[model samples]
Target: MKSDERMRLMDLLHVLKKRYATKAYDATRRIPEETVNQLLEALRYSPSSVNAQPWHFIVADDEAGRQRVAKATPDIGSLAYNRPKVLQASHVVVLCARNELPESYLTEVLDKEQQDGRYVDSTARDGFAAARAGYVKQHLDAGDVMFWNQKQVYIAQGFLLLAAGLLGVDATPIEGFLPEALSEEFGLEEKGLTPLVMVSLGYHADSDANARLPKSRLARDVVFSKA
Candidate 1:
């Protein structure tokens, strides 16, 4: 590879190695509007099963909104530890999963795909639609449609974290909350949405101990093997 390409690859690897789940955020430090928009765009292109795109994000960029999202996490146990992260972060994004995948939704997505030149021919479009339907049906039959939808949302969350890393922002993926409370707090049921997970984004506070800890992972030999 060329020197520039090798340097680019090394830069990305360094970002991955340096990242950590920030435990505290400097409430005063905010990500720029342009950078935040870029992160949102990264989420918009996150990969999903057949590009189903069964997710929505509730971004709290202000104190009032963050307070509302923080309602689900009470002051108790390990969950309380994350409450401050939400309230103090520059922004908090609540990733939600669609409660159900209706045929109409899939049809709408496929129509847009055709408009965007996603298919070379009508047959290709039809086959893509059929495959998406088949996978949705299989999940429904197994009684795990919501679970599967939530998984897609998780995949998108990974994209957000990666983008945050490359942008030199601190991030923390949070799950220590009452799911039912979160759904009710956001009135997601009425909107056909269910809360899956939340991620806090900002610069790490001086008190953020996790930011100072060394990166830890299993040995490459133990985690990866030739197939």
Candidate 2:
């Protein structure tokens, strides 16, 4: 890249880093629709395991709906009423992970192969063949592989949070809501999705105590190392 362009990029990076502060907006603050679209657009580009892209987002907007979620996820800590506020905010974005049934993976790959014009060399084809063989070896005797699938689903969750942070929208990552209760409350099966985390977005409120707390972090002594 040219020097001028590199310097411009660096300036933008500096501004973004400096601007990365958390502010909790109260439910009363109204969020604009365009801002919501920009946040979701950022998530659309986030990377996923094997491009599985197994995540869905549900935006909850009604009073009864938020109350149901608030009661269900109490263990999510401190902010027990967060779900209701989330529903009251200009918008509430819910992140969900779709369960991946093992049989469907093979079905998807075969479908992609049938449509694409790209060629896979014998070595690459053999590598995938070997991988499938090994996956079978590890799980054939076991009754389930739900744990493996959930781990990948979390990558999508992380992406959603980071995207919200980058869009200059204040968000609270909510997991305290009742899962099964929320699913039934939202009529999710009707939409072919499941709830994961509830994120509330809008302008920050002056009385939010969380916005006043210092950014907490563990010392490098415990968190990192050099070989």
Candidate 3:
């Protein structure tokens, strides 16, 4: 590899190593709007199976909205641990997945693809739609449509986390909250959306204890395999 290319790759590794699951945040500081917009774009462009894109992001940057999400982590339950992180972060993004992909939803996706010049002719569009229909049908038959959608949402979460890290922002990907309560609070069920995960974003507090801890991970030999 070229010297410059190696340096660029190393920079990305540096960013990944620097990022941690921030447990505490400086509430008084907020990420710039420009950076937040880029983070949203990162989520928007995340890849999904069959281009389903069956996910929605609810950005809670306001006091009321943040408080509503924080409520899902009640103080006396399994979810209590995440309450402080949610409340202290400058923004909390509620990652939601569609509960069902009705025929209309699939058609909408294909229609947009065609409009975006993804197809050269009607036959091409029809072929793509037919292929996607088969994939969706297989999952539906197995009663895994919701599970499939949830998996896609995690892809987007990864994009958000890496984007935030590259932009020098701290983030915590949280799954220890009450999904049902969050869905109800945000009227997600009415829209056929289910809350799957939440990410708290902000600058880490100067006094954050976690900032001083070393990162721990399994050895590369145990994690990676060459087939």
- What candidate 1 gets wrong by more than 4 Å, as runs, is 76-78
Q: Sorted on TM-score, highest at the top, how do the candidates line up?
A: 3, 1, 2
TM-score of each prediction: 0.94, 0.67, 0.96
Candidate topping lDDT: 3
In order, what lDDT does every prediction score?
0.92, 0.60, 0.93
The better-scoring model by lDDT among 2 and 3 is 3
Which structure is stronger by TM-score: 1 or 3?
3
Candidate 2 off by > 4 Å:
1-24, 61-80, 105-144, 187-194
> How many angstroms is residue 168 displaced in model 2 relative to the true structure, after the best TM-score fit?
0.7
Where does candidate 2 have its weakest 10-residue lDDT segment?
14-23
Candidate 1 per-residue lDDT over residues 169-224, each given as its tens digit: 89999998877887888889998999878999999999988888999999999999
Error of 3 at 105 (Å): 0.6
Off by over 4 Å in 3: none
Pick by TM-score: 1 or 2, better one: 1
Model 3 Cα lDDT, one tens digit per residue, 70-175: 8899988787889988888988999999999999999999999999999999999999999999999999999999999999999999999999999999999999
